[model samples]
Target: MKIVTWNINGIRTFKSGIKKILDSFEADIICVQETKVTRDLLEESTAIVDGYNSYFSFSRGRSGYSGVATYCKDRATPFLAEEGLTGLLITHEEAVGCYGDQLEFSSEELLALDNEGRAVITQHHFTGADAPQTLSVINVYCPRADPDKPERKQYKLQFYKLLQSRAEAILRSGSHVIVLGDVNTSHRPIDHCDPEDVDNFEDNPARKWLDHFLSGALENGDTEDQFGNISQKSASGGKFVDSFRHFHPKRSDAFTCWSTMTGARQTNYGTRIDYIFSNRFLVENVFSGVDIMPEVEGSDHCPVWAQLSCTLLPSPKFPPLCTRHMPEFIGRQLKLSGFFVKVSEKQNILKGYKESLPGSQEAGEIRENMNPVVQGNNIIKKRPADKEAETKAHKAKKSKLTKTETKPQNNLLAFFKPKQTQLNPPSPELNPDPGSESSACLTNAILADDTHCNSTQTKSSDVALDTCVSVVTETKNQDKQDKETAPVEMCRKGPCSSFWKEVLRGPPQPPLCKSHNEPCVLRTVKKAGPNLGRQFFVCARPQGHASNPQARCNFFTWVDKGK
Candidate 1:
């Protein structure tokens, strides 16, 4: 699969440029950095391409700022850091409030902390290849424009440490991992077009950190020269051996980025800050790597691409899929209608029983029996109870159901228990408040799962590595329980099902101002510009209305309350 990495600067402004690159280059996986758009903004924005899954990790910036996004034609699965590693430190005041307490320190302190943009990794699964390949691709936009600042340099060092730890973990798992992005550093003097200017050359902190990482050295200049002087180092690494590097041995100078603001490519004034590095074992044969320096108008950075070929391996086998089954004891009780009817009528039935029957063997048995059933699929079967059994149950119960005959019968169970339906038809006047009781039952079911649910599928290999089945099963069970107990609204004499249904069917109108009790809307008036005649919403209420409109009421929602 062809994996490409590029720092698209601000994704919103450079989206068209990015689309052009993707359309022409045909990359299987693309790792992007400096997206500078929030998840909410991205959701509102439309992508120009199809057949690609995109993942974005955005910084908390109102306007354009530091951010990153990843796109892949293959199946892209988001892998968050175990302890919330996918976040950026606030550099300004507005960002401080956006993240709130999520940041460890104050805005000032965080500014003193790391200022490099966020780092995000997205794993892609490729099936067509011989082996089941899982590629961990990372995008990083390190700090820039503060070449003289010591604090900024320290931040870059810390960033490299964090990145190296993450990369090592992936490499240890025997997975093919690729780390790429704009490192904002030129490894050698040859990496820059003007190699003769030493006075203008500031120290390359990004290159220094990367060199330490690759050489496993603790300090700068700690390792001996493996590839001769800096000039020769650049020459050996710079060239396209053939059109693609793996095909030929001759070196050709290729640069990835150019200075657009100064028209510097004419004077050959550009630095090689962008790079792609793979695990040593994974780079058996490097086909080609090149920096595309086209005249892109919107962004300062250019897109980079790499192509490689490797020996295919057989797909690894995982353990057989285990089927989850509900416990038989609870399944029998759910089959009968009486259990549901009694529970629905007595809202505090479980609490009352627990209080009265404390330490009782029957109470313990009931708890044990319901535990697995609640955790598995949230479906509790009710066993049939005749008149004698009902009498016995009532004697054991701590609370009595008020107006027992006025309970709504279960329509779902009526099909199975046809005899019970014929013997005692449900009264037409029967009405049960399902909303409150159902919510209470759902809460209890979720709590029960929290206490008793355990992964049934166990792997003999590393337990930590094989948690996919367990994680998927837990999510599935939670979804099932949530669906079963979700509120069922009573629709009016209309084609739609509920209040939300009608609201979703059309565009929502602006809500009324809470303080003034009048219609309010946020308006964006355009100033003098060529982009004229654009309409925006404002408070429709006339000036000096009955009450102060208080701008736009944040608490107010635009929904028809009558529904």
Candidate 2:
């Protein structure tokens, strides 16, 4: 089984990085830190890794922040801590107040205890060659750059102590465990690039803290020695050794963390702040351990992985049946779908059809039938001398008579050839104007005032006026209809309009920051491009009573009335 530990920074943004690592290492179990994704985000974010089961613990911060996740390739049942020792639920009130005050608290009360907001443990049962084994995996991302002035050092110390205590508890559980992550500490002078930058002992705070944790003598027959010389024998009497000292016993100076600004890791100018520690008793054999340094943009940290063989046991079996009788329905369907025709072959099939068309055959037949017969155009003639001469004379006379008669007729016909006319005769309708004086007089008499005239005149005049008014009204109505039916030219207006429209159409709400009681908004600084300017948005209600600058708002709700 291969196991890997990497601090992926932000899992959503670092998915490609993690994918590349997973492809190369192919570790059975992977532990990641600094995932910076919530439980809801994790479901959508990691859907690409098809054959693996994942366990994640997100920080209490709005949505994306310090978090950890573990992935197991095998289909193993995962066991997550109800509330792990990371103090994920420990409230500030509970921590400061007496035990009695916090004794009656529910799970909600533990939220106040969350500090650095990292750490998660996932257990997977493995069937090894020997017995059914359980592997406990832990991922951690410690706090960096303390804020509190006077107690910063003390806080770091206390954090390390908590971590060590948790690690001890896991070890005592008698399960095979892999405790690996960014310890945020350099153990020796060789662990960092600039060891002389500050006072030697004071500069390496993490080293001092770890040393203090391992200082007291162990009663379990394990001993803590100086740097480059340390070994631990497990309760099962199996010896687990550190590989760094074995590979480079004389160097005394190997590092892992590097300065991103200077590309220091490439030149071996960094510290070894990350580690992968394993239990000795469970490991039957250790193959190798190495840090992967692929040339990639983003993130300063490198990934480390290990390969080992362990004695595995058989998993519990419920019942046994004939495995060979299983159905192959999906597999057969996929196999059939995989067959396809090549472009060249398809083109050939189309060409064959074109050659067999009715039009092609008809054209070919017409060309064949048009061939001229040699005998009809210029036939071979046999002749007797005397008779031939008489025959020729007779033919000449006949030809002459025919020409004489035909020539006169042809001349007459040529003389009578038709000449083209330029002007066209007018049609009968155009010859006489429809609206003449007679017609106009008749129309006027028909439409004259009716009250002083006969009965027919009265009725005709009334109908004519009514018809004219109706026509006019219809024309006005048509014009109004045309105007109302004109096409509207849609304009996007501006970036704000488009963005706000999308926000309104999408999820109706944003995540709220628990502490500030305001929405959480993600801020990003990135490289610039043409037609693209930097983006920054203040709270829509900046001066409102509930506004908080630091608070996060990942969701936005549309205010239909702009209230």
Candidate 2 lDDT, 1-563, residue by residue in tens? 67777776676545565456565657677777777765455544363355555555556544576777666653433433322344434322221111112333344323322433566665556666666667666667766645445465555555565656566566666666666777787655555555665444433566555555432223234335433223232122322223343334335335555665434444555677777655554432443444444343355666666666552222232111101111221123355645566768656645653343222222234334333335867834443357878998999999999989887455677778998672333345323355864344334544754223335646666565455444444545665765565433123334556677766775324445455566544233344544233333323222211233432233343333231
lDDT of each: 0.48, 0.50
lDDT of 1 by residue, 341-394 (tens): 455535354564454323333345555544334446665544433886788788
lDDT of 1: 0.48
Top model number, TM-score:
2
Q: Which window of ten consecutive residues has the lowest lDDT sum in model 2? A: 318-327
Q: What are the RMSD figures for all models against the true structure? A: 29.6, 29.2
Please give each candidate's TM-score: 0.43, 0.45
lDDT of 1 at 479: 60
Error of 2 at 518 (Å): 49
